[model samples]
Target chain A: MKKTTLFDIISPVMIGPSSSHTAGAVRLGLLAKHIYKNTPKKVKFTLYNSYAHTGKGHGTEKGLLAGVLGLDVDDRRIKDIFNSDIAKNIDYTFSYADNFKKHPNTVDMVFDDSMFVSGESVGAGEVAIRKINDFNVKLTGRYNNLILVYKDKPGMISQVTNLLQKEGINIAFLNCDRNAKGQEASMIIEIDGKMNTSIEDEILKIPDVYFVTYVEKLEN
Target chain B: MDTFEQLYKECLTKNKTIYQAAQENMAIEADISVDKVRSFALKSLFEMKEAIRSGLISKELSMSGMCGQDCYKVQQYYKKQNSMFGKLFEKIIEYALATSEENIRMGRIVACPTAGSCGIVPAALIAISEEYNCSEFEQINALITAGEIGRIISLKVALAGAVAGCQAECGVASAMAAAAVCQLRNGRVSQILNASALALKNVLGLTCDPVAGLVEVPCVKRNPFLAVHAITAAELALCDVESKIPLDEVVDAMGQTGALMSPMLKESSQAGLAVTKTGLKVQKQVFD
Candidate 1:
């Protein structure tokens, strides 16, 4: 009954075979690409449980690799993934893990031997990346310019807000996830914002801020 | 009965009755009895050929017909030629004929549910169609029987993309094809529904992940396997066997299972296929 269902049925173009195994994989990958610090060089993908077993057949391998390469799901090159020259540009390998504790389609990616991104393909173009490298965060990437980090001492939120205000950006939603007051915690800020190259530099410069990343919302 | 339960029951009973009536109408030849379901399938096939040969359906139309029965619902797909159902219907029959010809030539066939999933259904459907020269009426009867099975799944397991992903799409398509095969083989409607239930139950949470967000890559080939699976399940059911639970129960279970399924597994491509590294790469390449 959801509107997305009708859109999917009505969409003129859909990649072959299955929707979840292909389209959703690309969306998740695109999110990760935006979040990563740089274009990844060497990537290691650890597929947990069912993903490790049946993923290859479903073209998850191509889907994941294409995502790291920052390709959209509609690209025709996806079919040539196994033999693409672009795929050669990135060093990628896949392995399986026995972690059922994670979602069935969980993929833990180690990007360029630096950033460790862990996420699950929830289904139908939806994903939740629980961790990006060491920074712990949960986001669906449904909108543009999402920022998450560990909340620090007092005035940090105010300072962050002032910095965004200086950049002529407005905050749409700022959600903080904390265990206890004054303790180390996480915050997710969804904003009507865009990272203009300097945004990352500005946020990373903040003390107590572990890391900074950007996410662009995918169109339905 | 609960809503899902009642729907499943209705599907099973109706499917059974239609199949029985169809089978009872099949005329025999050469010391062998033809199946009503096969007869119906063959008739559909012949009609497709006639439409194509008479220019009511063209090569393009026939090719589109390979997409199966669902194509009729959205006639605007061929807006270049004008949005017309009459033309679309002709094309639909042409595609069905072409698809059938391709399957027969390919030899190892897969029948998509009815001729709709003919690419997959016939992988199983033609095997029986060829085995027995079933008439067009019998094929329609078998399709109606299969439709009941499909309806049961739609009510219980979900035909909507938001629910069970591509699993319900092609998976249910395969299940329906298998049930029709059972009917053609003279299996009781209960048996036919059982085969359908078994097929759906076996592949419950399959995801719909079209690589590159296009319905090209795995979608075309996947139908054939679904057709093959339908045949396998039907054969299993016809061997004096039935699901320990009735078809309706399986439908109910499939619906609940789809409900509990994650949104990622649905057709959004945001999850299984859309979220992968390769998925992103393909997407970027496309948009860039």
Candidate 2:
């Protein structure tokens, strides 16, 4: 069928030494980082299916640790990350899970904190960040602009877009997921433009917004 | 749009059969430039040497220079738990095992253009870079050249795990290695790609079936051999020995050969090492 996008079609940097282990682990880790934001006081990373059974062998444990530590997939620091100070901040464990919706290479990461996120590494370093702290959101790690976690309020979608439009930022793709009206919701806006700190600050000012995070594509 | 299909059509027209184009594209990311390749490769080499010097990667484990059972020009960095390669060697083994888990999770594996021999290219390239102090930008460029070579092989022969077994894995890795080396030597794109295709075509139809289905056995040990082969293949191609076989035709032959192979020959753990008494016993032990 349909031709996959560059991000969709090709991803050179992956878990390391292998696309699945190095790159996928990194993606899964990045998702973990995105959702958790601040390092988890403690991380009960249960590797379900393939992750739990083979995590330690695959460096998934170290990779997962590095991802939580906010390391890129290609960062050689990832190899040494386990011994770093950032690593000491969080306590971690690895286990496998057999049942999951996405892929066998699935990992169900649980952060023992107020906010949590879970994701799947489908393959080729492609990741689907499924749930963040129980808020139902699905996004590929390829989002180049802003990440919005908020409550589902009327006009909230356009409100976020208008702010970006006024800032001279072009929206490449906008994905929004709402669990229930007036409850919790999430939006991932991929922009053709870079986001400065002001854009992030303005978004956080919104009443229903919980928190905001932005990742630059070239950073990886 | 038409230009995109040109690569695919050439692969098919020349009788070169590949696993999937979408998969091959995984190696063509924007960051994988010539400079990046040199940086990564040299960094990898430097790291390997540092590990050895600092007693991280172990001399026995890292001091690979052996010919193995299957291929003639094969070289392995370390034996399976033999010698005093010690902790670092053990760590590498552990990392090799984890790679399988990573592959299963990541949706589209490039195999770095190879599913079976995926670990070798990166390991070797990175290890070499580490030992030599190459920059990241340089490593990325070498990788780009290697990726192009791998793509050429996908067009020329097979990069699949099942077709040529570990030969395809290690063999193509060597080919990619050769291309990378050629590029490092300031060779042009055509020379690098040709070298890669030649390296792969020369070893087409190697089989899979890791002993006991573990990424260890031949998997872990095979990397160094491919790493060296990559060097040799690059050197040979650089010397301008005409292989005569167009890259596409050879890849097609690899595909046909793979299709003709018994299921055991694939990564299925059914044949070869998987059937040996020790293989069966180890497999049973793992499951038990």
Candidate 3:
């Protein structure tokens, strides 16, 4: 069993109606925003199953938008956020559907024209980033995370991790998902501490590394 | 990651209490000073109190308008009634409703195990602490004790309606609150464990049937009901009452029962009260 912290039991002092719907929505949105790495000019949210069915009641849609706008999970302004000036800067639309295959409280985020990120509000204000664009990967945003979209080639993994080892940043977890043999692959590494800009530049310097993103740990 | 039994035995051998063992173990696991743990627990207590303080004055409903203002209604009823449960009883009900209502309106709250069951622990701890005049330090210890109880149960079952329904959420919270109240009265380790087991064992099969898939309706009302329920368990435990099954075994039973539950009865809202004619109508009215 995973160690359940007193913080996990008693904290996260969050804005609520539902933790999974509201707080988890904010978290997923924050992670997607981190992956996108910019203030989105336009966005579409595809809420699935229970999120579609009961999201409005729980203010999940509001929570998601507030999160994308860079609001914290405990921000009181999220309740009336749609009317806020910050919301006026973005173009956002919501659609609902039931995909029996997806988790009940799942959302697919479409950012700009090309960035598509899908995530799930698993429960109890815990979220997991399930996919980025068409690439399937796993990220929980619990730790400082490094994400890489690169060619599937030998030594690529070692080269990326070797940079971290040189920087003395301990790797907490690492995951790799590839689209095809010797083709495009996504690698997500959760590290214990920060990987500075120099480390990023070093990783990007590797051959066949298409893109790199560093996502900071979510704020408590 | 010692089991509760292992922790208890260690406490007895070391001549330390269960809460002390919990605090020491947490201090090690989190790599923080024990005082830091105490301070962190106090932070949660303050958050819980803030929720109650704000919740008491607000009359906001949920976004769906299916629930809310019931806390206000309870406050009004308490003001006029003179007979039954009296002030402390009135405080428990009113505070529970208040905190839960605040949660629905998206106010900041300490989710004791969860947002849906946030009200129960605060209701019990605050009421008893205030009436008995316990210090904030004592209150933190009680809350930490409660947190450890909740933590142990959650190890067996994920404390969410989607996973194990309200039994794991609200039921476990009631158990947590029971342990807290036991600590407030200076109950022994055995008594505290028994109180938690009694509270949990009674609500073993309780379903997480939030109507219209919202945490309001039964969830908000259930907070006060279970907040009061913790009292029965704690009172019995203080008298040296024992649960036939141990606390760990009771938690294990809860996990087993959750595994055996119908998918619809969980937070999916596909069955139970969520499927009632009124529930379906509420869903349509709010969503459609």
Candidate 4:
């Protein structure tokens, strides 16, 4: 029910056997790439349910790799990604699972043997980044956002938002998810507009905020 | 914010056309100028044309080899016999087939509402524009009108076959194409909305049953069929034939119909034609 754009309805020229399986797979890869903030030397994809069953016929695998390699959805090179030079440099493997608990079109992108970002192709080429590592977080790329992984503690939210208030940035939406009390937690704050590297640096300067990722808004 | 009635009232209050209101609405939403929205739209239009051009020539099968160059066959057939439906009809069918075939082959395509339903709007708009010599601005207006209709309906139902069956994809796409073509021919707001209503009402409970779970078979061929379907609705609306149910009510009905629809028929490919004997055989031939 958001103010849907003509682009949302009529655009995003893409390579397709499907929008959700192909384009949306590419977007999930892109989001995973953004979250890691670096290309992994090794990666593994765990596709679940429908994606696991029909991904190959749909070029879902190609789109997923092409996206992590920084290809846009429309790139014709997506169809030949297995033979593409970009995918050759990295170690990548795909495993399928049947998980009714997950959405029908869902995957977990495990980067560099450790970082795991789970997401779902909700529908219509739209996606949601649901969990990072083990924390339940929401990153939809609907806005310019920050994902702060820190030791969970009181006053961390206020500390982060107070810095934004000083920089004249407004928090449009925010969510906090933690592993346990006083342990590893993440604050996913979707902000109004562009935030420079200085904001990330400022957030990192906080005592318990060890990691920060500035996620750009999604193109599709 | 979701219904056609709101958009209609907004259009009337501002004395702006549906296209104008859509443009203004997009500009406001994205915090950009209307020119940028129009520019982006024109880019999509060009890409749609490019997809058709490529598809008319290529014979690339889908990854599963279930569908591929059916469009080329249609073009060849048209050249030989000339279509019984006449020039515009031939153009509509050929362009629709061309674009959807292009999509299944992994060629570039604009997802007008979605990739599975991409062919309808462009097939209608391009056929008319090429035949009638409509200007680029007029084409943009038609696309904007189509987009607005899609946007309003999407507010009620997510425009995905997985969410709401083919009614949300090809069915809504047919309605969007009707609105676009109606606008291109200078039908006013009322007629445009009615065209959309008629197209949607006719396709209620249309399922998403692509054999082999690919956007081929029914999807590619459905493009040409539904592109022509839009024409019927547009023609009736042009003659001042109003829909029994209004546009807003039609969209609401579509939403309710989608909810009432069995999940098996809504792109799960578990029931309907997807699980037919031939469908299972193709699924085996492709995936097994």
Candidate 5:
């Protein structure tokens, strides 16, 4: 279990109405932004279950858009993000759905129809990115993460861990997913220490490694 | 660190107050200085006060039009007549409503435990501090004491309405507020714990059924009600009244009760007041 701190219990001074719906939505968008690594020309957000039903009143849509545009959870501009100048550059639309299989407060961010990042607002303004396109991944935005997409091959995990070992960086959690044998695969590494572009550059140099992104932990 | 019993033992052994023990423990857990922890808490305190200041003057309705003018109405009422309970009571209710109304209006607030129950702890702690002329340092101590209470309870139960119910959100907030108020009143460590236990044990099984699934209906008004509820527990504890159940045991029971509760009543908007006749109408009005 993750350790609960006094800050986790009493802090995160944020724009409110509902923590799971509003603040968590913003976090999901922020994480999605980090995972995407850049802003897209267009994005479509699909809110599911409880988020679909009550998201508007709680400003979930605004939160998601504001976050995608790099707004923090506490930014007062989130309330009118639709009219904000920063939001003018990106075309955004929202669609609602009811999928019982999905978590009650789930959203899918389709960026430029090229990247699909699905995340859930898991109670108390905490979130977990569950899927990135076709690959299943787990990202809580708690620790700095190193994400990689590559062709499935033997020893893909060792090659990555070996690089971190050389750097004296500790791996806290590692999750790997593949479509099938010898097919596309993805790796999500949650590390205990800081990340530098040098590590990401080295990972991208590995054979069959197509993508690499270093996501810094969210600043609360 | 995981249970109130352990926290109590540590406090007794170290001969420290709840805030002292809590800040030290948090400093170690978070790997930061005690001063950093207090500074973060002070930041939230200032935000809470700012929310109250902004909310007290605004009468604008929330996006759903269900709430937002309530704090203004209360302010108006107090101007015409004082509350039967007196000045402290007026401050508590006004502050509670102001914070909550600000929330639905998409204003800033400190989610003490959560945004839904954001008003409870601040209203109780801030009101008492103002009424008693407590120092900023004393207020920080009380706030840390409240955070410690919530953190311990959260170890036993997740402090979210979706995970447990309102019992875990507003219920836990009230308990935290009771502990904060008790600490501000200079109650002993045992009495502080007793105050929280008294608050938690009474509000067990409280459902989280917001009308139209919005935090406006019961959530906005419930803050002031529960803020006062917290004071009752503090008053009782300060007078040497004790809960037969220990604080840890009460939290355990709360966890059990939440598990036994129907999912429909756990922030799903499927049963209870969320599905009432007017609830359905409000839902349609808001969504359709």
Candidate 6:
């Protein structure tokens, strides 16, 4: 069973009209921003289904933009984020689509025409970052995570786990997906301890490693 | 941790009230002190109060011009004539509207279980606290009890209208409020649990059928109605009324009911009130 804290139920003071559409959108954006690791010059947001239908009234667009700009969900500026100076610094656009295959409240944030992060507001104020780029992954932003894209190889998993074990870090969850044998693969590791640049650098040192990014947990 | 039965057992064995057990367990899970847990609840409590304060005076319509004045209208009505249900009833209704309207206007509010149902717990707890002159610490304890109720129900079903319809969102919020109000009134642990059970048992299958797919219309008005619904549960529980079925069983039934419900009624706006003629016209006016 998932261990839900008391604070999870009663808290997360936020600007809202809907948790799934508004606050949850901000969280999805925050996770996407963390995965991207840097502010992109432009972002294209494709809102799906319910998010597409009622997103404007719920301020889903504003929440997504404000989050990418590093604003917390409770930030009052989210209501008028479009007029904020921070929003002016970046180029962003919102497009709508209907995909019954996707979660009702799903969004894809494409940054600078390169990185694609798709997430869904799973209900309450919780969200899951389901896809980063083309790699299918699961991230709930509940723990410090290390995401790596590398060539699929036999020793990749052991190599990564060995490093984490040496550092006395506990792995809460880990998922690795590859398109085919010995092809491009993605590793998503949720850890119970803190993460730093040194740990990320060690993962990058491994041969065939293509990309590495550390995603910090979202604040409650 | 998964069931209210376990929570009751833990509380009994540990000689703690529902809030005490909940706070201690959360403190251990989050690796924070129990005081820290209380402090977090306290912060949310203050924010809830602030939302009510801001909402009470503002008649500003939402971006869609659908809601945001109902709270003002209710306040005016109450000023001219008191509710037959009394001042506590009037306060709960007025505060629930204020907080929910504030939410539609993009104002800050504590998402008790969820933003759509944020008003219920605050309206019930704050109104009762004021009526009875409860202390801040007592109010926090009541709030924590409410949180535990929500947290437990959420374990069985995700508290989202899209997931389990409004039964999980506003229905659960009403249950949480019942638990909080029961605790405030010095009810026993069983009574508090029973209060929540009554609330949940009664609101099973409440659909998430907001008109125009917005959190207005039924969503805004539903807050006050459910807040009052919570009081009814608390009143019954305080008088030693039992829910026949256990709280855990009620939650199980709710989960099953949500699963059997059609997808169209689960925040999709394809059925129920969302697709009514007036609902369709409003949708066109707002979105087109």
Q: Which candidate comes out best when scored by lDDT?
A: 5
Global lDDT of each model? 0.57, 0.56, 0.90, 0.89, 0.93, 0.92
Task: Show pairs that collide, candidate 5.
Answer: none
Q: Candidate 2: RMSD over Cα atoms? A: 8.9
> Quick one: ranking by lDDT, best first?
5, 6, 3, 4, 1, 2
After superposing candidate 1 on the true structure, give the runs of residues whose Cα lies further than 4 Å from its correct spot: A1-9, A148-151, A162-173, A177-185, A193-206, B1-90, B93-288
- Please estimate how well model 2 matches the true structure, expressed as its whole-model Cα lDDT: 0.56
Best by the DockQ measure: 5
lDDT of 5 by residue, A1-220 (tens): 4778999988898998888899999999999999998978899999998899889989999999988998898999999999999998999999999999999899999999999999999988989999999999999999999999999988889999999999999999999999999999999999997977799999999999999999998988
C-alpha TM-scores of all predictions = 0.48, 0.64, 0.97, 0.98, 0.98, 0.97
Error of 3 at A88 (Å): 2.1
Name the 10 consecutive residues with the lowest summed lDDT in model 5 chain A: A1-10
Clashes of each: 115, 89, 0, 0, 0, 0
**Among these predicted structures, which one has the highest TM-score?**
5
C-alpha RMSD of each candidate structure in angstroms: 16.3, 8.9, 1.4, 1.2, 1.0, 1.5
lDDT of 5 by residue, B36-91 (tens): 99998899899999998998999989899989998888889899999999999999
**Candidate 3: segments with Cα more than 4 A from true spot:** none
Interface RMSD of each: 12.4, 8.6, 0.9, 1.1, 0.7, 0.9
Of the true interface contacts, the fraction found in model 1 is 0.02
lDDT of 3: 0.90
Model 6 per-residue lDDT tens digits across residues B23-85: 888998889999999999999999999999999999988988989999888889889998998
- Tens digits of per-residue lDDT, candidate 4, B21-121, equal 99988898888999999998999999999988988889888888878878878878888898888989988998998899889888899999899988899
State residue A167's C-alpha deviation in candidate 5, in Å.
1.8
Q: What DockQ does each candidate score versus the true complex, computed on alpha carbons?
A: 0.02, 0.08, 0.82, 0.81, 0.88, 0.81
C-alpha displacement of A91 in model 4, angstroms? 1.8
Model 4 spans with C-alpha error above 4 angstroms = A1-3
Q: Would you list the rank order by TM-score, best first? A: 5, 4, 3, 6, 2, 1
